[model samples]
Target: MKSFKHTIRALACAFTIAAVSTTAHAAELRLGSGFGDNHSSTRAMRDVFAAKVEELTAGRHTVSVFANSELGQAPEMVNQAQSGINFGVFVSSAFFNSQVPEIGVTNMPFIFSDRETAFKVFDGPFGEKMKPLFEAKGLVVLGFMELGFRNITNSVRPITQPEDLQGLKIRLQNNPVHIATFNLLGASPTSIDASEMFAALSQGVVDAQENPYAVINSFRLYDAKQKYVTDTGHFFDVIVFAVSKTALDAMTEEDREAVIEAGRLATLEQRSYAAADEATNLETVLSKGVELTRLTPEQREAFRTATAPVLDEVKSRLGAELVDEFLSAVDAAK
Candidate 1:
């Protein structure tokens, strides 16, 4: 009789342990980004996001981040996120061209004059119209993360004018709009993944590349391989955190709200960090012996003029109304 009682007690305890383990497994979430913690805006945002989520979830939910293309490349990760193979991705708009072509409009050169104008369009109608398109493709568009205005860096020579860029083998993101813009400016643009850019530049695979000051510093582009830095403000890049709609739908209401609120907080913090320290970053790079080439107003205008045709092509492909709405928001912001 005592043996029968002991068996019953053991079975009850086993069932209780299984129930607790199952509940714990259901509360975890995964996030993906192509860059690691040191130089990546995505990683900065993710770090803050994870902290916020833990706070909002009251420890009920946990998040894991895969940085530096741990899961896959940026473009492939986006597809994985959408297919519900993972929870979310912090990805640049360049990769979105494959899924939603309209967002490529951001890559059009000189469309934004500065960070304020860029945010005006992104936080307004231009960004809103893009929300549905992501949904149609099975992804959720979170708010924008900062990618400062891109400038050119080269080991070859100073790039003060569009002519200077001519015949230079430049590394460009794999987006049609960006490739077209560089080609129009007379560069021999080659599409290369960001992870390989350092080695590519080191091995003379490419002579020049362009990215923001933050990126230049983060990627350690001031190393001996990169001798010149030019603030052309050719175009800006934006990273948006997206979640798989299928995975999002599987979450409880409380969990979804926690994820979103965390993203918003992290974006605001990261943007402030990027914009507030430009002077320091610039000084650091120059101290490393890199020549800083500030474009003369005339030279900037000349470059803009050369790239104007690319805008027409982008609008036609993305739709005139889309561009109009973006411009309207910019005008309103002013």
Candidate 2:
């Protein structure tokens, strides 16, 4: 009977220890983003990723998102994640070009024909190959979310031809390839963070900006006196979902796997939502009294041909071998 009593006591102690360990392992991560809370990217992290992480980990993990530059702009948030001050951030792929110029290869102007082709490339081996680039920068790329095709918006005038952009002061993301492309197209490009863009346009600090229709509608860029919007679709932008290597490394094996899987599923759903809403989002912009211009094939070709030199410039900046491999992968996807 004494042996039986001792065995019961030992089992109770073991149960107490296990419960304590589980409580100790529970983690609450903070996610940062440059987009508003209502944006698709933010919604994905909140509704999908956060929910899945809690469910997958059985309440052992949770993610709290800070949207709309609440943490900081893209570069600042990226730095925070790199330094382990923030757990993760969802930012445009263009922003990553500053750290890994090789990423610029993916931002080549007019390279992708449509959303389908773009999605194919990014969801394939080419996308897998780019993961290490972030890892090298102390970031673990979780998945790629869609920002969709970027269109040009200006307060100056309608951009119908390549020549129309001449003398226009355009605000571009701090991306060398983007600046080069705009310069080749005859616009004076100024690198500006997204948070500053609305005020820049409103105050005439910059006369033009380019972003996806969803972005234009969400940020209400039209209210900043943007009268003209052209479906230039010059570049397809991606929102990279990344976690700090520090945070990821600290996770248990099961928790890490859960995080990755949750990220992947969230990205897939976000892309589908963005793609499905493209037309409706464009309509929303038009309803706000903004003049929408659709480019004819010849007009689009003019912009494409004018900016073709940018490809060579990018190749020179971001190694020929890497660019070639990316192009080959894109071709294979085609």
Candidate 3:
């Protein structure tokens, strides 16, 4: 895949450059995501999101969807959307932490028990409260999709407790809170961009990594020799669907409405797809002979206790008032 990217690198660059052209259609939106072509999120973007945009706008606008970091890594594509280089982005909230530290509140370890609780929190008022933070950074918050729970996958061994992670070098998303969580748990964590994770794991630069089942299956991390998986369910994460505020501001009201509607419908469908496919994705890894470990109630509690200080640390970094408000909102959602 890396070679393929390099082979057509110049042509893909031209296509992306053309995708953002202002002389074209109403929005001519270029949506970029880190999901691979076979991933459900990619399917949602191409089949549902892009189709809805063109249909709602009567073909006056169009979306060109790029997947697997073909456009750029998560943060780079986000920067592109913010700068109007692209029209929209579908990426993990962890990438947004750099811009809005308050968003880190959502990634607190062992925060939610299941996917349903997260859905209620994000789809309700608490989700609304996080929008302004993104808007302030030049991105329009459209809707949220499930990135779901993160778990550990390694070539080393099955992780049954917090101590099992000791001395294991894990590839974590570029989030400070995540790094802190792993550090306290006794693992050496590195911030490797998801785009390069497989290579890093395959080449033995890192012995282990963590991701949701969708990412694990889509990236085929098992092929890189990461065959042990533990169901930690540490952080229930969300994928932020957003567009450039600058581009939206310039769009005609009708075109803007179509774009927003496309995002809304796509987000709804993506969450539905994520919920159903998660079990199937786990089975996929297991079929390939990857070992699976489900942490027991007592085991999960141990992890929760170890990572508890991370919450206070983040609250201190991003005002206690805002973080506490987010916590209150989560409680309200429950």
Candidate 4:
């Protein structure tokens, strides 16, 4: 315990040294996210997170937000937070695997059938277990926001079954678990940063990509000619709302409470918005002349079967006991 507190204090010193405040007000906490300005996550950051922080702190502290990866790509922004240049970030849990592999427990293919079970498992002991892993690496887990279930999109043709994915180049987040799932289904998966995805699709750098409807619509991928979508819902992704332990410790106790409260409120609001907006986003995409394919239970089962080995793969990487514990937690929740 003494060593842990020492670690926290050392981190706070590093952050304080990086950004020295001169005026009566301390440097505004910079919060960054990879989502675009129009995305719900970005909106939550602006209206709920930033606003609530100021409200709770009575204007003594403030939060400044940069949307659309304005701070940098996922890895770059993550490094900045660790270095104490930023206070908090909203980034995909997949990106943090390089730092904390246990995060992949949530990335297993077809693991979640619906939002209720997903939230039950994540908001319970599984979430508590994951937080300390992050703290050990200099990040404080503020909360987890829904990125929602990911779907597949391409210019070629509608994918009605798992066989249709064979040999096509698909763009996926830089997650090994996702890559393994797609590989088993016989697709060539490439890792592309979200910011560069539009160009890659327009130039035919990759033939298809998978993301939630929010991403396809908000990022305007249809404009890049990705007009066909299959609602694969392969993985239920989460956005980790985390603060750098360095920056977190630099704040006054009251200020820290404000940040935590803001994160909690924003997370709840964001989840509600995310759940309700998927239909609206799908409507917007259909209005753009994008072809949508909704899979049947049997068809989705084919996918579930093909990607089943991904569980074993993840267990190999993260450990069988831990992975089984996560699975058992999901079962208990169900």
TM for every model, in the order presented, reads 0.91, 0.92, 0.92, 0.92
Alpha-carbon lDDT of model 4: 0.89
Q: Which stretches of candidate 4 lie over 4 Å from their true place?
A: 1-20, 23-25
**Candidate 1 per-residue C-alpha lDDT over 33-104 given as tens digits, one digit per residue, 9 for 90 to 100:** 876566446656557888888889898877888877888888888989899887788877888888999888
How many clashes does the backbone of model 3 have?
0
> What overall lDDT goes with each candidate model?
0.83, 0.89, 0.88, 0.89
RMSD, model 1, all Cα superposed? Answer: 2.7
Better of 1 and 2 by TM-score: 2
The parts of candidate 2 lying over 4 Å away from their true place are 1-26
- The digit string of per-residue lDDT tens for model 2 on 1-334 reads 9999999999999999998886654477889888877788988899999999999988889889999899988999988888889889898998887666777899999888877788788888888888888899899998889998999999988999999999899999998888899998899999989888899999999999999998998889999989999999999999988889988998899999999999999999899888887888899999999998999999999999999988788888888898898888878877
Q: What is the lDDT of residue 285 in candidate 2?
A: 91
Candidate No. with top TM-score: 4
Judge candidate 4 at residue 75 and give its lDDT.
Answer: 80
Ranking of all predicted structures according to lDDT, beginning with the best and ending with the worst? 2, 4, 3, 1
Tens-place lDDT per residue, model 4, 165-253, is 99998998899999999999999999999989999999999989999999999989898889799999999999998889987787789
Query: Candidate 1 at 150: error in angstroms?
Result: 0.3
Candidate 4 clash pair list: none
Scored by lDDT, model 2 comes in at: 0.89
Query: Which ten contiguous residues of candidate 1 have the minimum total lDDT?
Result: 36-45
